[model samples]
Target chain A: MITIALPKGALLSDSIELFKRLGLDFTAFLDSKNRQLQITDPTNTAKGLLVRATDVPVYVEYGQAQLGIVGYDLLLEKTPDVAHLADLNFGGCRMSVAVPKTSPYQTPTELPPNGKVASKFVNCAKTYFQQLDLPVEIIPLYGSVELGPITGMSEAIVDLVSTGRTLKENGLVEVDTLFQSTARLIAHPLSYRLNLDNLNDLGEQIKNSVSKS
Target chain B: MITIALPKGALLSDSIELFKRLGLDFTAFLDSKNRQLQITDPTNTAKGLLVRATDVPVYVEYGQAQLGIVGYDLLLEKTPDVAHLADLNFGGCRMSVAVPKTSPYQTPTELPPNGKVASKFVNCAKTYFQQLDLPVEIIPLYGSVELGPITGMSEAIVDLVSTGRTLKENGLVEVDTLFQSTARLIAHPLSYRLNLDNLNDLGEQIKNSVSKS
Candidate 1:
């Protein structure tokens, strides 16, 4: 039996829908009141575990769940040991560098030497600045990295830019895009090696469905 | 004028109540729909900046807000360069080491050498185990640390424990407490030094009200 971990909130519906197209009946697992962390599918050949989006890769890497769906931003941030099977192409966003709209530091070079750049994705920010050969401080913030620049805590912020509404409202403007992100289907290395045929079939089905949609 | 950063959710009410006792009217700032991140009192002698609980210390440490009310757990995790003023004593919890209820490792030492301990507080967990003279792997998880042991990602977890219901439900048990935690008042170094008299007066008012309550 193959167990899959699905992120609970915004990504849940899309994951379930994708699985359904692959002939997997995951409806019972979607019941809001179930409250059960683990639920067995009607066929009992697969199980679903609801978890926080960021923890999806952790579960897959540990082999608790053979498969998972998570955002690419998380993959860049944590860099967990998991096989990046296929891009599901949903939950699209861009990881970008932002600064307060009123800041004098518009370009990356304009930033003061060794000025701090706050972000939830500390690793991503580090890599981005390193690629630019810029030595800057990365201040890790769990939420609202937009407020970092607005409050002068950091000269700039590296965070996900979706519709740009959040940054605009926070008086921040996107300055540089680090990466384009979407949800990806990931699997444990051991699981992929052992159940190659079944997992590949599942992966192929998801890719076909996603392309058609 | 004095600027204070208050956490947005559970701790907001208690923080406002504490400030009100000092004759600082902060009710208008408490409205959930205000959308304005910064709001001033009617008299303009003080202003409130509502921010995510986890970012409270960041604002204060950066001098964006002179003072902040935040959980002690965050303070331990971040170790910001801020004055640890009076312990507000609310939001009480413990940073605990937990493992599967059935795990054979009863004590921290009984666990396999070089075993992993997962937690959102990566730095805190690393420091705790390092002090125990254990060579343990620290897996940084953003949420659901209980799943670490259940999924075999880590032999144990270090996380915040309040009611222990979450752990119990996940078939995990607390093994040891790293530290006892509560909400605290933190201030930037320069702010405390510059506004020494006013800050002390505010701290005294809060301490008095806390004792009376």
Candidate 2:
């Protein structure tokens, strides 16, 4: 049997739908009343573990879940050891550098040297700034990255922007996008190489579903 | 006017009540209809910034907030350079090492060497194991730590246990406690030293309130 780790937030539904295409159903997680974190599909051919998006890759990397669905942004940040199986192409968003609308800085590079940039994605923020040869301090704020600028603790913030509503509501303007993100299917390396539980065939089927969509 | 950073979760109401003793009311944060993250107390003498518990020290350490209320657990984990003022004594909990109830390992040291211990408090976990001269891998999981044992990803989990309800419900038992945690009053070092906005007086009043209770 193959175990798949599904992230619990924004990408959950689409991830479930994609898995449903393979005739494995783990929709029980979508029910708000359900408190179970791990569920086995009715067919019993697969099991699903509902976890935080950041943790999906950890489970796959550790071989706790032979397969996992996670965001490309997490892949970039964590850089966990997992096989990149397919780009599921759903849950699209972009990682962007944003600053208070009133700030004079118009782009990421324009922010002053040694300025603080807050984000939950600290690694991504650090890498982006390093690529630009900008020496900005990345303040790791796990929640409310928008508050970084609002509280004047940071000159800018690096965060994922989906609909841009959050940025707009927070009075932040995207200065530069680091990368566009989409849901990705990742597999345990050894599992993929050995074709454990017909993993290769299932991956191909999911890839086909994504192309059709 | 002084800015006070208040944590948004379990410690919020108690923190607000403590501040009420100082005649600065931030109760607006408790109203279900309130969507504001930052609000001026009706007295206008101070402002409150509602933020994640982990970010409280970040705000205080950066001097974005002259003072903040946060859990000692976070203080220990983040080890941010903020002046530790008073132990509010409310919002009490404990950081414990928990494992599956059915597992044979009864104590932290009994667990096999190199066993994976999952926790959001990675630093605390590492410190505890290191002091014991036990080699263990700490897997950082930001959410749903109970799922660590359930998913068989880790041999144990280090987490904050309040009523022990979550651990009991998840079929886990606490084998060892690292430390007892309570909400603490903290301030930016410079702010505390310079007595900015009568910070020393406010800290004294808060300490008095805590002792009186």
Candidate 3:
């Protein structure tokens, strides 16, 4: 059986729809009252493991699940050893360096040296600043990163921006965008190589579903 | 005015009640519909910034918040430069090493060498394994760490255990507990040293509240 690791959150509905197009139904996760993390389709062709978005890649990398659906940002941040099969293209967002609207710095490079910047994506933020050769402290915060600048704890922050509403509501402005992220189809390397349980064929069918969408 | 950073979610109500006993109120955060991240008590003697539990110290260390409340586990993991003032004694939990109930290893050292052990507290888990002279790969996962063993991605997982309901549901058992954790009061080092805004007095009041409770 080909078990799939599906992320639990905003992108869940889109991910379920995509799999539905591939003749596998795992939409039980969309139910508000559904607490089950693991479910199997009526056809028994596939099993879905509802998990945190960040853990999707980890599950696939370790061969627990032959396939996974995850955000590109997580792929970049986690850098798991998974086969990047196709771009599912639903969860569109960008990672950017943002500062309070009233700040003097307009761009990331314009910010002062040795300043503190907070983000949940520490590695991604660190790499971006390192590429610019700007040495700054990247404080790790798992949530409400916008609070960093508003509270004066951090001069800037690097975080994922989706609707841009959160930033505007918090009185912060994007200084520079590091990358755009979207949902992608990922597979375990060994599973893909061995083509176990028709894994390769199922991968192609999912790719076709993406193209059709 | 003294700016206080209170953690959001389960700890917020208790934190606010503790502060209430100390003569400062921040219960606005407990309102279900409140979207405001920052609020001031009617007396205006203090301001409260609602933030993630992990970021509590970051705000305190930067002096954006002269005082903060966070879980002891966070203080242990982040090790921010803040004055550990008092323990509020709520939000009790423990950091533990768990494995699938079917696993043969009964102790951390008995687990397979070089096996993956996932946890959000990377530093703590690393230290625990290192002390046992057991070299294992510590995979950092921010949420739902119990899935690590269920999916066979990890032979073991080191995570926070409150009632162990999640682990029990996931067919995992606690092998060893690293330490018990509770809510703690912390302050910016400089603020504590200078006794600004009657910081020392406020600290005493909070300690008193804890003792009285």
TM-score of chain A of each: 0.93, 0.98, 0.98
Candidate 1 chain A least-lDDT 10 residues: A195-204
Number of the candidate with higher DockQ, 1 or 2: 2
Question: Which digits, one per residue and each the tens of the lDDT, describe model 2 over residues A118-176?
Answer: 99999999999999999999999989999999989999999999999999998999989
Candidate 2's C-alpha runs over 4 A off are: none
lDDT of 1: 0.84
lDDT of 2 at B148: 88
- The model with the greater lDDT, 1 or 3, is 3
User: How many Å off is the CA of B184 in candidate 2?
Assistant: 0.5
Q: Cα lDDT of all candidates, in order? A: 0.84, 0.94, 0.90
Native-referenced Cα lDDT, model 2: 0.94
lDDT of 3 by residue, B76-102 (tens): 888899999998899999999999989
**lDDT tens string, model 2, B66-158?**
999999999999999999999988999999999999998989999999799999999999999999999999999989999888888899999
Ranking by DockQ: 2, 3, 1
Q: Which one wins on lDDT?
A: 2
DockQ scores of the candidates: 0.62, 0.85, 0.71
